[model samples]
Target: MAMNDGMSGPGSNSLKGITFLLVDRNEALLRSFQETLASYGAAVYSVCDISKVKDVFKEVKVDVFLADMEATGQETSALIRSFRDSNPGGSFFLLIDRVTYKDALSLIGPEADDYFFKPLDPDRFAQTIETALGQSRPKSNSLAVIEPYVEQLKPYLIFRSPEMKQVLMNLPRIAASNQTVLISGETGTGKEIVARAIHVLSRRAEGNFVAVNCGAIPDSLMEGELFGHEKGAFTGAHKTHRGKFELADNGTLLLDEIGDMPLSLQVKLLRVLEEGVIYRLGGERPTAVNVRILAATRIDLIK
Candidate 1:
């Protein structure tokens, strides 16, 4: 259904500067919706193929994603999961027709912010988007406390939520300490970005910040990846290789997805953390590393 081109009354530009991505198979609906949102001063972009959503996300910082669940078909849940994995910060709104409203409602959990039914009120839809943006906007008081840090992180992180501001408020104190920190949150929630911010605020700001994804490395090669290896230590160990620990000496080492590390390697990791020394593979002597360790995990290790 297409919306009329009637000019909205005063306060019509409530969505000014807001970026929106609309996903729907119906071209006519997309054009009308895009025009309505654009009239309200929103930068609107539409896509028919859900597969191109990720590409658009990579190219632009989308403020909100309005997706047509009916058009998305059976892959809606999986696509939403992928969106959360890649851009957990962006707001997601599902557009469902009356027939599948209940089914779409089930998809609105931590990942989705809200949902709207098909044949939407153009004014109401624009107002809803503006309201969501307003609610997530950071309060002045909270922003004041972390303004400097936020400024420093502008190039690396994009967040303006009170929850994130609260998290940032504790960063200064946390960065001052030499103790190891475990940052736990859902996937793509900017754990790595926080780790980098800590490094930037800490005394090790001048030193290198090295990050290693514990889950990405193979189990067989994980040990050598973290502790380095001497020449001929393994089949492909042609020369002495420096591991993440040594590379981050006098700096910060972020072990991302730490929960994925193998149990065998965890023991060694504990020893290294306690001793501040690493015994490289096939090496008799221990190498001391003056690196601060920051661990990030998506899983609940406490459980």
Candidate 2:
């Protein structure tokens, strides 16, 4: 389905430039799946070779990763964790046989956002993918027409709050620039929704808009989570993982709850902000990221 013009605040379809990495050892299934998503205007890359998953990620800029759990199984869990650790910004899903739907849920648990059962229902799959994409899309500035409730949409977002409308009016103008934006608001104020509107209105709307919740991350691994780490960088590091900066190389990075970030990691984060480069935990090279940083905080950063 085509997204309404300017519904996402004046950009093209939210899916237009976003990429999907569809991995399955099964050629027929992978093709069928890709075709289904493609019909909905998705930019899907289907990969059949399991061994080359890393190669694809390294070369391609993908916004989401969808894998066949039935085909990948436990053998891929380590890979999944590794992927999650490195590319914390991308959304992940699993495709499983109907009989193993429960098994799929149990296997991936919180690791995966959702999964598709075998004999895939095209419409349902489309809806699920859209919802997941909405969740993944970075919040931009847009008019918030607070109705009794807000539903995800393409162009204009409906909300009932007049304050939100004022914010939306400014979005179009604000989106024209490429300066770093830091949104401050209370919980449930829809900081992300606003951020996404800005993304849709901005020049980089065609590129990926990745969100990373700084507060949701555990303090223990915050370093490895944002900057990634080389395999054997630490005790549990079995493989090289991609960090949020790497995943959002040319996209927008929403640093949610920046205030909650531990003081220790703040030093490293400041360097990234200033230098536009990240150092993997165990790796020596400082990789550069050309990303638009949009941060949200519930507290008064000025204070």
Judged by TM-score, which candidate is best?
Answer: 1
Q: What is the lDDT of residue 87 in candidate 2?
A: 69
- In the range 148-180, model 1's lDDT, one tens digit per residue, is 455666766667777887777677556654557
Backbone clashes, each candidate: 0, 24
lDDT for model 1 comes to: 0.76
Cα lDDT of model 2 by residue, 1-303, tens digit: 122233332122445666778777778877776766676677888777667777767776666788877667765676577667656677677776634454554545456655554566554455445534553344545433222113322344554577876775566545544457899999988899889877765546667778888889999888888889999999989999998888887577889999989998989887775566789999999897767789999999888
TM-score per candidate, in order?
0.53, 0.50
Q: What RMSD does each model have against the real structure?
A: 19.1, 16.2
Worst 10 residues of 1 by lDDT: 1-10
- lDDT of model 2 at position 206: 67
